[model samples]
Target: MTDIRRIWFGSMSKTLREAPLTTPNARKGLREGVHWRGVSAEVHLGYRKGKRVGRWLVRWRLPDGRYKQDGLGAADDGLAADGVETLNFEQAKSKAARYVEQERQKQQDAGKAPIPTVREVVEAYAAGRKARAMKQEGARPDDAKGRLSQHVLSHPVAAKRLDVLTDEDLADWREGLGAELAVSTVRRIVNDFRAALNGLPARTLKRLPATYPMTVKLGLKVGEAEPAAARDGAALPDADIRRIIDAAKAVDKAEEWNGDLFLMVLVLAATGARFSQVSRMLVGDVQPVQSRLMVPTSRKGRGQKRSTHIATRVGADVIESLRPSIAGRRSADPLLERWRHRQEKAKPGARPEWVRDSRGPWKSPTEITRPWAAIIEKAGLPVDTVPYALRHSSIVRCLRAALPVRLVAQLHDTSDKMIERHYASAIVNALDDLTAAAVVPLVDAERGTVVSLRG
Candidate 1:
């Protein structure tokens, strides 16, 4: 049993009370429920004919002047049934007010257009970049798609609506990633995100977030020494280079390694060109008369063309060996063609021989890793050594031979600052030899003076 009270409903006053389901007055309405005037609606205590407990329901007027109804739960019974709790008269009134407010908000939201998600924007940007890359001639593979899918789209932040994205949300995501990724790698990914965001259509995103949380924050000043790993990898010693080259030659003789693989090692050791640059060289770029090799632009920079002299005898010899294979091809043809795979040779349309044909350029020098690793292992060199180490070794050789850093930088199409940073210790060692040549005579002269005095 519950007390009866008088309550106002919009403009009219009504009697409100809670009563048993069997009361004749409770069944007077067509809906068959004991209804009470609530804060924003008429709260009803209703029963289905066969149910033990009655449910609380609310009927309210929408902004459009249409009546809407919703069920809150069973009426207050003190005990919870099957994990469903009942609400009292006061609780029903509060719930009804909340229901009405929620309905109004839903209606307001329905009137506006939907916003894009972070993932949707990223995906659109990636698709656009991929399409542009495909349209360009000789475009390198676009890695942005893979990177965004793996690092950005997979993140929880991708679920956030684009319009509601804030700097704090981005900062939290960045901070979370900082625990697992290196600062440099995080900076690269963040820059990738910025690039993606900038690529979005002006109509889609009018402006970027105020703060880019993943920007590098190492506090490093200009001219500060970079971490050793950032500068370069370990340079191969002369002994290791010799051993590896000899092993590659032996492997070629044994028919386990391709002749081109051996020549690639020799050329890399001689010219100091990056793997990508060397892999993309065209036969016409080689000039035996001038002893120069015109290196094309690669993925390193914005594809700036550079020319480097093939001063080493080994480089000249390797170039001569490759001349026979490239003699008849057009100047635009790739110098190094992709080797025929063993499995491909057995295919129906396979070529009769494995000679270098005009099929096209090898996609990358990195594809030669299988044979390169075998040769390194056979030579007992460090297993961790990579193809880039050959370039480092070549540069260090020039430094040791007293070559000027300016000439080396010009040859490699890089800055003298880079050479000094990576090979400073080697340069210092070379200077010691120059200093010894001058100091040794002074020491000999002093020794002679001491002998003459003793005599």
Candidate 2:
């Protein structure tokens, strides 16, 4: 029993004659019998001047600081409670709770503001997001708006009342999404919808049923092994990685690209940092003394964007190759910058084009596509091979090498849970390799062992 109920029972005498409101004498001695708090209502026993029985009364406190009162059945005094004509303390509290909920529902129906629908909640959330993002520069509020418009705004569930939404309704919608969308995409949609529900106004949220689906209940994992195809498809062999690096150097030399392509590709392979992160690196970020590279993270999610760096260990050869890029450069200068090429109309009314070229830091990943394509062609890699494949290969290499998952996650700037979630098969294989030594034969004839060694 709960502590409050325990106190109610423990405080009473065993004989029941002296227990609170159990006997005729106990009921007549007091003006009011006893009271206890329910969820949002309170139940009290009403006593008469000379009767052995009392009536159960419930009081509901409203938002306007007013209390609404109602009568339940008679409190069990001389007879046992059947939950109909008479009620025990526990039954009375339960009945009062149900009554309060019904009254609240009635008030909601009659109020000026109607109960919120899925569409309303999602739109409000998107609007609020945009308003908040306006106060903080660079925040992308349209992400939520775009997702909701595509997945929810046109769906049937969007018109349904939030409080009446069933689990099956949500499950059906999620299952339907799996037919046309990737598992990761469905998971993102569900998470975004849940965030919208949570972002609703406090009054609207209070009206939602407690059992509403606020999270994806079905298996949203990419697959049984979870994204194994994507992981396997993106990763390359160690030999291929070496070939790519060599090809990058050769392409830079042949194309007169100023070694920027080779160095950028080298840093990406060695550190496994994203293109955005690598683009933000400065000369001081290259720690040749420690043989490490301090790469900045992209901080993709909500909240204040703070500059965070992950110190990734690299080989001495990588550090040596990076020194030439950093040599004679200011500490704050971009580590890998090159001349930018652009074209503009020669005049407002003329169709002729003018070359507008200047040198500065790399502003976009598309800037490297030309050099990357040449490198891929030189290495004889697949036409579909992307720069991000290098990151996948780097992570797989670390896992196959049996590096600790925690350390690998640190180097990749992600959580161990994320690592396991995305690379379950790789992690399982690594575990198998780690535990291979624990397997021993039960019998050893060469040692002349006899009988069982088991305990």
Candidate 3:
């Protein structure tokens, strides 16, 4: 019943004497005892060194009558180094069947159907975004590439073929990422991935997967009560603000401090400008006569320049104080000089010098982070308080002063909706002030019964 001529025992011939021994077929490279035939492939069973060896060696005949042989995999039992189950005889047979089915399907699929992977789609989307960004003035090329690198390309699901991707696969990926990343961050990344996949052209792939399942939630469900408020920095209290300002002034007077640290903090509080926006401000951007400061186009502005009025008297004072330093400087010179550490020599033990540096009116804001942190620590402020808190404090103060939300939004170059969402507490305080100022309490002469009235 078995083919003895197709089996070769090799070194196990003496040990496997009870089993059938035969010569290998030079044409097929197949040594076999019993070869099982699938619809279009064959699985060979044999022996080597007295141990049973098997493999799925596909032998299919094309329409032209020529035969093609493909060695699928080893059919013997073994464990992979990663501990995943290796293909056994039965599994190999199943794989052989699937391979043949895939081949048949490929023939029906027009012979050249492209099966692009998730990685390919992500790459294509990133490239398209980069090209579009390059066309726009002041657009950073690395922004698109960074989003892909951080959110989509590094994901394990990126290796999966697009045609076979399922909602379950995406859900699993989200679940895994949820373990390491914040839920909001995970949601954003997942949405970005979905957007990238959906943005792929129809001709590039067969079909896109379903939408992402989990919506971003800021609060826990009924059974789970965890603080889920979106933590986007806080408005510094007036006491903390005063303390920080004092500390910055003290640091400015220090021997090692080479730049105007106090002015930076004062500018952020007075104008509600981002660190980068303030750092990039030129000496010419300050208009003391008009009482206005021109904030250049930033990434947040989508590259459109905007102007903010100097709303506070203290702000005017701060600008006037800095005018003398920038008097002899060109309009293209930076209004504020940033400090950098320079070594006297290239040697490792050389003493460092603190030098002021500027780039054609643009001073880098990152240079101030270390000194700002030290000042914050020395001021007895919260360790978590950041430089951006100064802007938040300015916004809250403006809102609490009963300034119109639209006007405040215009001053910050942001939307009223953003102010309402981020400074709701300040809005409430302003409302309280309005009620106190407008409403009057009436008292009866005898009983002292009070009634609040408003015109």
Candidate 4:
């Protein structure tokens, strides 16, 4: 009593005759639907045509008379979706079936609910989050939202929804990066992905802690070496220290007019400042004064509570040799220009362009460190060291010279906790010297010979 017809997309069609929902072809992308007389019950299913085909069908009725079955797109997607059950619409069908069966089992026993779809979590993360949070702040979307677009929402993973995401899928997306991206890059993406998924009810997204782990353990780091110990205050060993200084000097002497490499190592050894802090300074901060400029804004001095001066104790000789004269200019001006003029005059054979851009201007901290390690290698050092280690070297030098801890902490721009974490071993070694200082004989009475008792 109802009209039956075929709906065609491309060269294919779904008809009352060929619908998989009511036919054996229903195994994979086989289209079948039946139109009954006077009633609106119809069946439809799918067919996927590849080397190994897949079929899945769903049958449900609209409470209204507009009844039909669900496997429409799979039949013609043209691949044997069965080859990858987790990928096709047919896979979604199988997933829904398992979910339904599980829900029934739950109902018969105690009480539990089906995991919500990935689409559900996504909508909530978007509406309940991104949209409102960005607008409510009355600003454009911040970096979090920007990263979200790249990691999810716009990725295939987002298309599937959160509940359906497996650790494998996350790994695939991450590994697909063309080359080896930095750990920091992978870490950032995972951070954004987790924030989105975790916005769902805790019951929904499983192993939020485990997502980050999968990226490190399962995919990227399978054969990577374990990192050497890194503490906030770890110093470069003395040999490495000497190597870095030697490399800097050699590199400078080869191109004496340029202070870029020379001053970097000097600050590194003298202050134990991070490469970032040293490189960011204009020529002004590297003042050729007797003291290192422990700027409040410096990475090493960023969090200090008061004016803290770390005595570089480099002495007037080194200061006068390197200090830039301002021609009555303020200390606020950068120091590189003076080095540039001197380098040009000293290396009269070298062009300005040749020396100025050794690795280029406004070099990033990491950029400086990369070559620093190279220079150390050229200088014949066995171990690689970074700029921050110089800070560690400085700390040890101070402790060895016996500067006060509270003063060291303030100068280093960190709490004693950070210093203790990094320099505990060096500090421990200094204790023997401290004990020696305390052993001076405490004279008893005016006439008594110096009697050795616990002082």
- TM-scores across all candidates? 0.60, 0.60, 0.60, 0.45
Q: How well does candidate 1 score on lDDT at residue 201?
A: 63
Top candidate by lDDT: 2
Q: Which residue pairs in model 1 clash with each other?
A: none
Per-residue CA lDDT of model 3 for 1-40, tens digit only, reads 3323332233232111222223222213444443433332
Measured on C-alpha atoms, candidate 3 has an lDDT of 0.60
User: Predicted candidate 1: what Cα RMSD to the true structure?
Assistant: 13.2
lDDT per residue, candidate 1, 1-455, as tens digits? 55576654556676766444433334333243344443533434333321345566676665544556777776544344332356655565566665565555456556555556778878888888788767744455677888788888888988987545655656666665645766666666776777665555654443323222222121111122237453334788889888887887877667644566676776677677877667767778777766666765444544544533333334566667667657888888777664554322545776654554434455655566887888888898888888788888878887788888887776665779889877888888788877877863333474565332333
Give the runs in model 3 whose Cα sits over 4 Å from its true position: 1-115, 123-154, 198-233, 255-257, 301-314, 339-365, 445-455
True-structure lDDT of candidate 1: 0.63
Question: lDDT for each of the candidates?
Answer: 0.63, 0.72, 0.60, 0.51
Candidate 3: clashing pairs of residues? none
Return the lDDT, model 2, position 55. 77
**Candidate 1, 171: how far from true, in Å?**
1.5
lDDT of 3 at 264: 75
Candidate 1 stretches greater than 4 Å from native: 1-116, 128-142, 178-180, 200-226, 230-233, 253-258, 302-315, 342-358, 434-455
Error of 2 at 403 (Å): 2.6
